[model samples]
Target: MHHLTGHRNIVELRGAYEDRHSVNLIMELCEGGELFDRIIARGHYSERAAALLCREMVSVVHSCHSMGVFHRDLKPENFLFLNNKEDSPLKATDFGLSVFFKHGEQFKDLVGSAYYVAPEVLKRHYGAEADIWSAGIILYILLSGVPPFWADHPWIREDGEAPDKPLDITVISRMKQFRAMNKLKKVALKIVAENLSEEEITGLKEMFRSLDTDNSGTITLEELRSGLPKLGTKISESEITQLMEAADVDGNGTIDYSEFVSATMHMNRLEKEDHILKAFEYFDKDHSGYITVDELEEALKKYDMGDDKTIKDIIAEVDTDHDGRINYQEFVAMMRNNSPEIVPNRRRMF
Candidate 1:
């Protein structure tokens, strides 16, 4: 964090202190709020505005890499305006997932948030190029209000030549469904995390315990808001609510042990053959080598979100063949291209 000083876009880490169980840093404050909120409030985000935002975002990446730091997580939530002024600088914050690296060095850990993670990173071997890819994703979302990839569905061809037709769903509802898809990825990845290295996930147990400071076995919104500062995240109250709701998989308005694991784990860990195979096995309950709609519904039922319509929609999104079931090939295709809800109606603007 101290290494990011003297950069205009980065959130400066001024000082640090340690209390019994945690270390805290005094960070630069950006009271203007998150990048997404500003875009949504502006109503009409013009290409000119998007270009300026993209430049600032990209500049932050360049600065980080030039300083030998790899900011593994680059999402809209991490960018904030210095103030409510129209010309406030867009500051890049959140270095919790960052690491100092030498030139040509490769990192193997599954870091970064959903949608913004790069393909090579998912393969568990990637260099500074991955941060550039993440910045590109932010640029895409800056213009479209959504990322350009989602589950590698046919319509989401990585090339800039996908179909231009809009979905029958309205944009507002589409946003909601897109958020739903993001949560779905969390649930799916949680299953894979269970079989991963215990040491890799053991930290999460301590994380949950700290957030559940009351030892109540669940993390409330207040606890989450308080605990976030310890982890170097400075989020607005509204953003905290959104995050709490997203991570509260049980809809109980609190994060449980399992929900925290799901919400905190990286969604791109599906690149490993064994990891994906384990997830596929969970869906293919009958060992039929295919994931039927019934099986999907049953799998999602444990989370109480598996209505018939959702099952149909999920299959429609990933089932490339005319067949109703998702075969191993289709499943692999979807997992390999893990990403955000996309609308390919426009030409590549980023």
Candidate 2:
């Protein structure tokens, strides 16, 4: 949980203390009460609302798996709402039963609440799929207002026997939907990558050459200001400085082809659109749909990107709208047109 604290749906770990005899952890406060209690309080919950809740729970579980962590024990009691508002956010809590596992590894443990435990878990051989099974149980309870299986009457099927336990239609539907969504996402990403190929890079190279008014291999501040207007866009000196500071990773005081490509291709290389959006959110800070100078400074501080003056200049270059902030569209354009070079790397899964 400490390593995975930044996710909105996972309870944040604020602090920790360890002593000779005991350990203490401080986590975010959740005031909306337990999932079951909140559902009961409402008395009338719709399928749509239940589905939305299930979606969030699945998302949190997916994040956990992505980070190579497994909750082991997932139940309604372990999830809490941040507030008592109607649209309060839900957060997964209690890492006491969590464990880290590597890709293709399996665990042998009789862990988790009886009602939510998966059959594989009971069999003493399980992986991240166990958490998905538990999530399905939570979805069952969310829609039916009662657990599908209980301690006294647990789900059971003999090994090698045809399944007799009835599966929840809602859960089955959700599984199919998630699989379909995953497939579509992969296809879309492939298409986007194909569109931004070497041919596209060649076109950008031509644009870059046109901007290098001095016939130099790099674009200086003066060239940027004069060249942008030819493309029907005006950029301030400060903004040009910011752009150079951001793209000029080698501290060359100018934007080179590698730096330009890095800035433009960074977001495109991402496998999911949500990843790009999340990257944007990191700099947005206030959820304002636009990144202000202050927000850019805060984000840059993390990367040790540049000093105050240099950071301001990069923001000026990125803020194409001239509205003193970089909106999502402007940000995306900057990413697509002026990105750093991305080295090919394999995606790690665990």
**CA lDDT scores, all candidates in order:** 0.70, 0.63
Please provide, for model 2 over 1-350, each residue's C-alpha lDDT reduced to its tens digit, 9 standing for 90 to 100.
Answer: 77797898999989989999998888899998888665443322568998888888998999998999988989888999999887889899988889888988899878997679998988898888999999998887676554565222223434533232222222222222223222112222223433455633433444556567676788887776665555333446675555555445445578766545444332325434454565676666688777787877665554454466756666566666578877666655554444322322223211
The collision pairs in model 1 are none
List where candidate 1 sits over 4 angstroms from the true fold: 152-350
Stretches of model 2 off by over 4 angstroms after superposition: 150-350
lDDT tens digits by residue: candidate 1, 1-350: 77778888888888999999999899998899988666443322458888888888888988888889998988878899999988889999988888999999998999997678998998999998898998888887666554565443555544642232222112222223224553345556657766777644434565566568788999899987776665343447786677777777667788777667655543334445678778888888888878898888888888787888778777878788758998676776665553223312223222
Q: Could you say which candidate leads in TM-score? A: 1
Question: lDDT score of model 2?
Answer: 0.63
- Residue 335 deviation, candidate 1, in Å? 38
The TM-score of candidate 2 is 0.43
